[model samples]
Target: MSVATGNPVFETVGGDASAATVTPTGRTTAGSLADLAAQVVTNTTDAGTAKANAVSALNTANSAAAQATEALSQASKAITSSSANIAGGYAALDGSGNANVPGNMAVGASNSGARSFSIGHTGLKDWIRFQFYTGTGVAANPDFVFIGMNGTGNTDGTCALQGTAFQPLSSNTMTLGSSNNAWSGITSQTAVDVISDLNDKNIIGTLGNATYADVTAKLRVVWASISGVVYTLKSGQSGRQHIGVIAQYVAAAFKAEGLDAADFGVWCSTPKKQIVTKAVDGQKIMSIEPVYETDGKTQETQETIRYAELLSLGLFCEKLERADLEARVAALESKSTSSTAA
Candidate 1:
């Protein structure tokens, strides 16, 4: 370091040297031994002041921390005493067996599309509802969704998911039966009714009356086809007996009579499946609506015939035979009368 002498004034703070204090009257000249000594003294005093301030700050921080600890202890005590059942207290709990949250609980961070899930209770009904909201605003009305257990009782095994607008959910479809697996046959207690009202008919044409020859032919083939058998199913209906004619034999009988079974309304050999069911609690529930193939064609899976149509054809044979017998009687009576006159 290089030093030069000039009459520059240097500030000095020196008084009661042991205390390291400041007194503004003390001043010194530049480059003098007294001034250099005064600077060293001033630096010492500044360091002492900083140390004192640091100690005071430490004391203040300790006092604030003590107050905070006391506050936290009081709060914890309040919560424990208020509810005996809370925090391992031995008291009865609510029906849900869990502590209830005050407000709606949000689930999942809002997705990229601003959609999220929430669980809240409907105000009046006390119905607990799970919701999904779409709007970005905090006050936006959310869409109620998800499965819920309402206060009222419902039929067992019917579990459904309702979405927005209270509509049944249709997101995922289920395939009911596989190509290898088939559905069980459903039974109805009552006989199936056919609509025969005049308004239901299309007034296009009339059925031509059958001739005696046609009746005789149909009666012979149909009578042979009417044989029934008692048997059990391959899946075996628990040893129960069933009575029905073989549909294949019925079709063959019609073929023998030179009549196409396909041309008649009585023949029902087409098999179709459009039914689907939902599984709830390991039990199947038939609640899903039937969906058909897009091409409007039914899958061929069964064969059946209308017994009513076969019985009607048999009655026609009776009417024709009666007419033939009456005509013979009239001719014989006339001949007898003529013979008597001769």
Candidate 2:
């Protein structure tokens, strides 16, 4: 398209430059081109600034990522350290780490210059305590004395010495039973000695050659030696009944092994009473005697007859009584038959 002007124009023969000078309404000027060049430069500068800003943001993001990775590594190390401490604490409490505590261990409330190692139940009322004294004179030893306390929470607990053999503390008495108790074992040497002494003193002549009449006469002498005196138990004494024949009487009766009814009758004639005294307490106390070697004449510290001997004597007496009754019946029947025949 060509611009139109009001000025008259001469028609140019094909491509001729003879056109009158025409003033064009629209034309490109130097100032407008300059403005367009400035706009292009401004756009390029803005695009460059935007690209630079994007690059800067990418660098900032990379730095942030690096810092986060470092922080995560530090946190992992801290967690591992904390876990190790926790594991150590657990080991200490359970005796898994310390050799001093071979089993379970617990620390009680601390007192001045004192501490207690406890085992068993955690309740303060019922626990076994290993107490170490820090005072003077034999207290510095780390070996603890064992103490057993119960929920009663009184001073009525027991303390034992810490040793290979568990023994009660000094001056502490251990009772076997609340009342009567039984023990099974050979009598002690001291008891044997006491019995030997008694046997020697109460020696009735041997019954080897003695007839039934002689046995009866010897038993009388043996019975007379004992003094039977009835006495009441003093206050605070054990309420157990003390009923037993004198040891000498039982011993002499045992010696009359093959006695007839008449001899047994003499043996039974001995008065029954509290003939035993405190002096013969051990001898009369029913117990099995220990067996030992003895010379023929001397009463050595050897085995003597026990309660079973007394029982045997009792059986003998019963047999003798039964034989006597049968004999009396036979005599009576023989008399009746003789009378009927007459």
Candidate 3:
């Protein structure tokens, strides 16, 4: 191609050219094209540097791809149910880094219906007991009662423990029921002691610290009110009439004398009563209910006579009356002897 034509065609390699006349289609002459040759050398150096950078980038991309493949393999193994290959551990799948919990632990029993907390040993005796053993064995016949909760399939859902009988830690200390609950029909051989020691007394005296005359006065008032009556019996008892003084009359007699019958311990007064919820009854008005008794149609406090106090007072009154009669007889005999001597 000619440079004078305004559109020059690229020349083939190893061609000769004369830069002095500016004809590019001919081979470039070495002596006349000094500045162009220098530029070509500089371009060759730049091309070599670019090729080296491309090769280095390709190696880095290949290494990253290999690392990504290895990470994917490890992640796949970690989520599996079996941990045989993951971080060299044989355990159940766990989120914790330590592979598994430190030691053996079981949340519940494997038995079909073993939902309730169960601790049993075949070597032990008949009771499937809940107890703490302090390296001691073979306790004697100690009274123990455990609360039994019957759920789902039971007819009665309520629990009752009838009396305050519990011994803690010791074989004797077994809690039978909650407060306001009682469990009866307990047959045990353990000895029960009623606390009545004389040492327990703080200020003990004869007949509630009453003087001899005071006792006699109380007994005389009580005897005057005792008018026995035969009244028709209730259905539970036989038709025979029962003889007893009205509790109200005794209370009235004491009131007339300006004294509180209850303070005297002659009238026993019971507070409002409560019947525990029965296993059969679904009605539970209160956890501990109050059932009041009716004196006629109106509610009234229940008061009963304590016959023991009354009987003791009567005996003392009889002794005093006998002494008075003996003294009268001795005086009468002395008078009769003096008259006979005159």
Candidate 1: segments with Cα more than 4 A from true spot: 1-192, 198-216, 271-300, 318-342
lDDT of each: 0.58, 0.47, 0.57
By TM-score, rank the candidates, best first: 3, 1, 2
Best TM-score among the predictions, by candidate number: 3
Model 3 per-residue lDDT tens digits across residues 93-179: 455653443344456544322234454333433433333223355764333444434333334433334334544667545656422
- Native-to-model Cα distance after best TM-score fit, residue 214 in candidate 2, in Å: 11
Candidate 2 residues lying further than 4 Å off, grouped into runs, are: 1-240, 252-305
lDDT string, candidate 1, 218-296, tens digits = 7555665666778778877588888877777777777777876666655656444454555656655553233345665
RMSDs, each prediction?
A: 16.3, 26.8, 15.8
User: Candidate 3 lDDT (Cα, whole model)?
Assistant: 0.57
Scored against the true structure, residue 215 in model 1 reaches a CA lDDT of 49
Relative to the unseen true structure, what is the Cα RMSD of model 3? 15.8
TM-score of each model, in listed order: 0.35, 0.25, 0.39
The candidate, 1 or 3, that scores higher on lDDT is 1
